[model samples]
Target: MRWGRTPDSAVTERDDDGYADLRSYAAIGDGRTLALIARDGRVDWLPLPGTDGHPVFAALLDAADGGCVELAPVEPYTVRREYVGPTNVLASTFTTAGGSVRVTDSLNTGISGRLPWTELARRIEGLEGRVELRAAVRPGTCLGQASPWVHETAHGPVLRLADMTMAVRTLGAEDVVPGDRRIDVTYVSSPGSRQLLGLVGTQAEPLVLPPAEELDAGVDRTIARWTAWSEAFSWEGPWSDAVRRSALVLKLLLHAPSGAMVAAATTSLPESLRPREGVGGKTWDYRLAWVRDSAYALTALFRFGLREETHGAISWMLGSIRRHGPEPRVCYTLDGELPRGALEADVPGWRGIGPVVSGNPAGEQLQLGVYGDLFAIVALYVGDGNVLDAETGRMLAAVADLTCDRWQSRDSGMWELPETRHHTTSKLGCWVALTRAVELAEDGHIPGDPSRWRSEAERIRSWVEEHCWSEERGAYVWYPGTDRLDASILLHAISGFDRGERMSRTLDALREELGCGPHLYRYSGMAEEEGVFLPCSYWMVSALQLCGRTREARELMDALQDTPNDVGLLAEMLDPATGALVGNLPQALSHLALVNAAITVATTS
Candidate 1:
């Protein structure tokens, strides 16, 4: 993951055109929001105020018009960065011919927790001779969603865009001069010298510009808070480092105020590194929390002794579902609302891929697997000795009734494709739901007709075993009457389903058709569409281990989970062939899969 050193004075990457390789960026955040900082020292993608907000710094999505905050050396310099211990604070050393400088960046939080408003703090210290650094704050159109402007304010200067007021506080630099939706300054770095840069933003509220000294001090407090949370996590596995990092990534994606976990910190990062017709044009906004993702997060969080996240997720998820009543949307906003649907934004998109999208259509789709997601979380909570309120139990029983009535219908499966079908995984999801419901009923946790639930659960199992199982392919097809295989079926490996020699052979069939290098394409016929889906491949590890192939599972787990980028962060997918990270940065489901896979193998092995 090293940048190329140039023969000339400046050290730069092959992508000197402002766009960076997706793999070269690292994620830094508070629980409220996240920012992607590229190797060249650009804060490329940031959803302002909150994870679900509009991106105020969106250069990652539209390099030309997308806004960004730059805090890099004026000259070319090679850079390397790592998190400061377990904290999301980033420490990067930039070495230029004149000297080397270290930049520590963190989303400042109070000693108690997150701040009332958002503040991005950058602390600059000189480690060597002398160097010149340039700092700029450029607000973009938010992929044609908003217009940004600058104006004078009682607190020095402020930038305004789409209901957000932004102010920059500097400890050392030139005077704050506001340009066309831009602010810039230049400063010198001397040995043992220190400087601070803080960007404070508030949406639909008065921007609170904290003092430079206070912001600088808050970095330490933020680090301490992160350390406390990370230290509180418990893990005894050999892959503790990897698991801990994944947990931290999940925490970063967690919206602390709402107790909802976002899928990713970013949007519109393409699935395909190169724009292929079927692969590249598709870009999704994954900022909202999904029931499936939070359910997965719940398991990992509960396993690692992170009770706050688990409880928050459970409360938010169940409450949101209760609000939806008859059926839950595939996902929800940070504030528990449904998305309006995706629309192609005017921003040219990452590297001119075009049609950068906003909102997720899955929110409106009938992902039948959501029943399993809903029941699985509730069952986990109840199994952990927690009590479900009568209201929630009644709500869940109604959900179970709906699952029984609709499990036979064709609908968008876990993949959330436009084409509806009797996806094997979808039916299995219903089976899981009903089985868990029956358990809950028998345990006196939730109100349910155990007889009916168990009967329907068996019916779902029989239906899948009959129609979904492809005798010709010797594997469970993606849907009934198709040769296609879905990687999500691997979830069945650990879903308490009967896994026997038949399931073992299906695992092999999936590997043969979907495996590329150490990666597995998300489904049949997707090898050329995009990078291998990270979660699907990680799910393979669970499938393998549960199938009694611990050695193979461990080997694959070692290959996948142990090989993240320099910052130990992974995106939604990866071009295993080229080693380019594709899709969004530090995806929650991907990290959750890694954590759960390790937990699965550790407990089994």
Candidate 2:
């Protein structure tokens, strides 16, 4: 299962362009926060203290000022990276002309739950001959607002920027130099030698440094926890490895304190790798949790036999709605508060893409899809023999009532487009909500007027059939007035909205119009404009399976799985032409779709 060259093989060196490809990065997390590690042995994107907190190492956005930590050989080398077994611990092997070294990276976690403070541990082991290692830490503020200063501490040298402080500890290093806004360390190792470098971060609090041995032990403990978690996954289906990896990625995005799952780890990574002049305004902050994304993730987790995460997420969603208001917002912070509105960053974004955003504006949009997402998760929960409390039942009924009143109105739709319209997908989502609510009421799972809910559901079905279907297009249009096609309607087949020939025809239409190879655009006219949406491609896999195209479904599943980076991780989108990863890394929706699609292929084929 090892990758890269053997000890006897002659190795050559390759130079890195300083800017690491998004696909060349792997993620490690402790359920509280996450850090992105490139194959070149650098920690690029980390939101210290909290997953939703401001970034301390955002080199993924602005490499110069957006902080980073590098601990690799000063000379160029080839890298072979992969996770340690099924755990989130990432191991990267560097092969040079002189020797080879293996570096293991992890965001330390405990067996009980997330640890109190954030810590990133890197352990280097020399495989053969002698190797020289260099390490550096450059601290940057949130969106290039301030630079860190070295503050000599009793324990070690601490990097401080405003209220944030981070302590760095090293083992077996020759010298440690503190530079302006950075710390540099150099060391040498012989065969069978090991060294540990650890960084612990805190916000406006006293920095406590743990012993090097203790921090090193934390890496082993974290790996054990991840292995134990992966062992509990009950999936023995197709693409089991991919499914488990996706599950692990999804777990990384979960805020254990609040049981809220964020949409992605990093925000403002552009949707396209093209120049900023061409694709400047499309960047957004996705650190917040969307009701739709969390709902879908919950459903996928349930299918994987993960009860704790499923129930935890459901409880969080219900509690958040109750705490915020009766109506569901498009998105919320990990703690259930509405996002503070969009804030533009001063620094250039990833690859010089400008206007890096901090907060999401979609929270204010009325996306009717939230109703369906909420009810759908509840339906799956209740159907799995779980009981709902009276308070939750009342909340569900109130949501149903709200859906009945708003089903006829215009909305921003699932994609959160600006122009409001009676999006067919929105109407269908309302139909799903009311239909599930009526079933829950009839089954005594929740208190509601089943007859009224059923009436509205039937009305929506009739309205969509009359207005949304385009006879000329031979498939469902994006809306009543537009003849455009949307990839989202492919979910109707899985939702039982229309499992007959019409949905099959819709699947074909989507493939012909939106499909690029196996990947697909979110909607029409997105071909040359944006990267292909990864989740939509997975949706096509499920849609194909439902349409009796089992062989094609499996083929598409294989193609979709192949699209992940070398480490088996998917971003939100992929460059249609170059296949480079675009948008946020470790996208929860993309992983969720992969898990669900694998399940579909297993069950159908």
Candidate 3:
């Protein structure tokens, strides 16, 4: 997307107050942490040290008291940027009448065994005649609670906040004199002139600050490493470039030590069209992990030839399953611990949406579809000829037994709402899990009572056919009672069950009852809460493709997947009528479904 021109000289002349416009923001983070950098050159939303840490930069909370780091051009310059190559290394080109500058930023890769440090490196090379630049450097501590002391050293001056130390290594700036949690400096660069600025934070232990030259070398090495990683991807598909980028983003979001992938790199961005709600209570600290996304992420990684992430996430999931028993929590922290349930924050929501939340309340909800999701992940691995170990086999059998016992019960289903129902999709999930488990057992991949599993699978299928189907509407209802059409039933269609004339009739009924302008809502607007679920709409494409309607499926897929933001990132929900992004951002499930839908259409066609 195009970016706004740099702020007017006056705005840059002082520490500007207020939040950065949503359109101007970009994200960067280590796998374990993330930072939001706006086009105006402010690092506004970093959770220092780790994803779960309190913000060292809390502009996402109360823009006034929330801290940030500012780096910007001195004069007016329009901005445009993208990740460098396929890596998360961000490059922004700033252009003005006199000259231009391209600034690259990233958190340098962690060494195999090295001290912890957060690095921000800025490189500026003049493009034309000359450009005068002004920079204001500020660092906040503990959610803007304490001011760091700045001291001048021979290498450069250091900014220390309690035990954490940030050493700035550069040649062309004045000393870092403190002012209201801010530091100011100015510099000028002619054509071909360059400058490198580095910020490194270290713990209270005896620290050895690397030399400026070594840090420079480290930046080059980090880029090279990212390049090699991208080059190793084995993806070959119609959306290979997009898939590769998504895979890279997934990689960047993966916490390697723990084998968890975060839903997104940011929190507190808004779902409503209103920008004010984008700030506080609207915030969902996505730094945690969800089991549903973990299974899907594992499959996606495996598809792109990243076996390590696949294996690691599965190992983590299995351990979690063993610990929590047959029923899995909807999500957990990176370390696989249960959440304390969702709570409303006293802080204002993102923008103005009230109740910035910490832990997800979905953790306690019974999303029975999770059974099938876990089964599908393991089934995919086994289908690829991988062996299932005894421990993992027990986990699969337990999941199957749980499905047999609870499949008929009403549940929150995959949506995680408060109202429970004998959701058609939940029963279908049980069918899927049992069906796959039987297949694995029959193939001697897992030790299970195949006859019992087959009987349970048939039982679910029979119940869905008899009860969930609607003779009046000529389709399957959202739940057992309501005639309201639901987009989630598309899951059943894609799962290879009941692909008969009746299923076709249901697809047509869905088109009329629940379909929006071009997309499909999760269900009719009769429900007071919930935005249109975008991923379910995409699931329609997969269903249609699997049902032998390739042309319609491709058309719908094109329309639905085209609704992402400029950078091809989708939110949790999109306005069915307006196609505007609503709900949470860069949703992993949405994108994962997109990739899978594309794959299905491509292969089947």
Candidate 4:
């Protein structure tokens, strides 16, 4: 039940300094945590207990002292990788001179979903002539923030990492040797032979080290559940393959317990390959759940008819905001708590970019765009014939009233920079939020003053048309006074604020200024600072279709759809010239944008 084409993935190679490309990694996860496996069979990033905390295999962020578990060929080999079917489970084949072996990797789930303890299983099946392979598991020091040590006992080797204890187990291997920083094993694979390595751990509870064979069976069981879920997915639109793949990637990012989908699995991957002297830090922790991201995630989930995830996400978002707000934080923790700002850890970032961080700086920003993000999802939920409880309705009504008051105030815009200028995108977000709130009140879904909300929305429209639109640039400038451009204005087309002549011209202006063909910088002056922002590129695809340029949208989408790495995963940004992935791995916003763009084009046309 494999998905995608023949897996002739990249020819395996590392950088001169020994690191895999950001695009060369695939992800597998249980409901609670995620693990990244490089195409060359290295488990480089895994956060035990949950997706929000510190990781054992933090090599993706810190190549030095950031531990990794390697299960790769001993001899020279070429490799290819893909998810096992539409599942998060990854299977990589290493073809050496002697033969080949298919290593299937998974973080096993229980019958009822997430296991009480973390279990990582890597099962090897020989496919051709005998091939020799090496395996090593080195627990990290939490990016030099905590101490980790391996203890050899009568039973086996146990890792005491921070407050957690991990038991590493192996079976059907020819040799096993243990060292201080790592545990190493060597195995020979003959045709039709099978072997396994499994790690079981718990943070506070006792370890549940199941038999190695049981771990192998767990991989099969997880695959079966993923297949059932994929078969149930509903997407008949154009580019369904890419849409489906994006959905699967988003599902992996969703924290099942709290229903809070993280922004990305791994953080501290640099957005800019090289930092500029005046540039702000390009590395930040994105493990926090952003309201904007979840807003797009709900839309993507609804388009697929995924009722459980749709409802789960909606509940988590509203519940968190209801508990924590009069005004919402830009993002929240996976467990529904406020986050401390991104605090730098003692590790060099990917490619030696320093200032790797925990937590996220955005949690403190006042991104007025979130009002639009929040109201849009709730409007969709109620429109689908779902009834909101009185508490949520009242809560939302207050939020709408607040939006009317705050619409005129300047705050950080969608990009969440430190700047507090009167950004055009912020004004448009408030406009969309209030506009939807009035509709909800008119429809009896809420108890807000529809007249007041409607007036504010119109006023916002007038203000933006007067101030944000720049006649000199023949487009909506970044704000009122400057000739700068912002790609986020593309969202206005999707929001129905402006899909006419002006927006069409702005789209052209954006392409001419911020875009190199379909590859777009997030805003003016960011061109030399970062890679093409992946989500901004997809937003333009939606803008194109909504602005009556269907042919252009489809053609651009066709070129970009096949650009995801061999495993159908996208990073936050990519070097436009080199096509090298940059920023965080498997970013949820990137995938969400892809899903919504494909769906918008298909449904609108």
Which candidate's lDDT is highest? 4
| Candidate 1 regions with alpha-carbon error over 4 angstroms | 1-11, 14-17, 278-280
lDDT of each: 0.84, 0.85, 0.68, 0.86
What root-mean-square deviation over C-alphas does model 3 reach? 4.1
Backbone N/Cα/C clashes per model: 0, 0, 21, 0
Which ranking of candidates, highest lDDT first? 4, 2, 1, 3
**Model 4 per-residue lDDT at 512:** 91
Error of 2 at 382 (Å): 1.1
What TM-score, computed on C-alpha atoms, does each candidate reach? 0.96, 0.96, 0.88, 0.97
Write down the TM-score for model 1: 0.96
What TM-score, to 2 decimals, does candidate 2 have?
A: 0.96
> Candidate 2 clashing pairs?
none
In terms of TM-score, the best-performing candidate is 4
Q: Model 1 clash pairs?
A: none
Task: After the best TM-score superposition of candidate 4, give how far the Cα of residue 134 lies from its true spot, in angstroms.
Answer: 0.9
Q: How would you encode candidate 4's per-residue C-alpha lDDT over 1-605 as one tens digit per residue?
A: 11123366445446766678777788888878999888788888998888876688888877778888889888888887778887888988889989999999999998887889999999999999999999998888888877778888778888888888888778789888888767888889999999998889899777776888889899999999888889888998898878888898998999999999899988788888777876744888888899999989988888787889988888999999988997877899998899997778887777788678888878888888999999998998887779888999899899999999998888889888888988999988999899999988999989966899998999999999999888888999888899999999999899999999999999999899898757799999887889989998899999999999999999988878756777788899988777778888889999999999999999999
What candidate 4 gets wrong by more than 4 Å, as runs, is 1-12
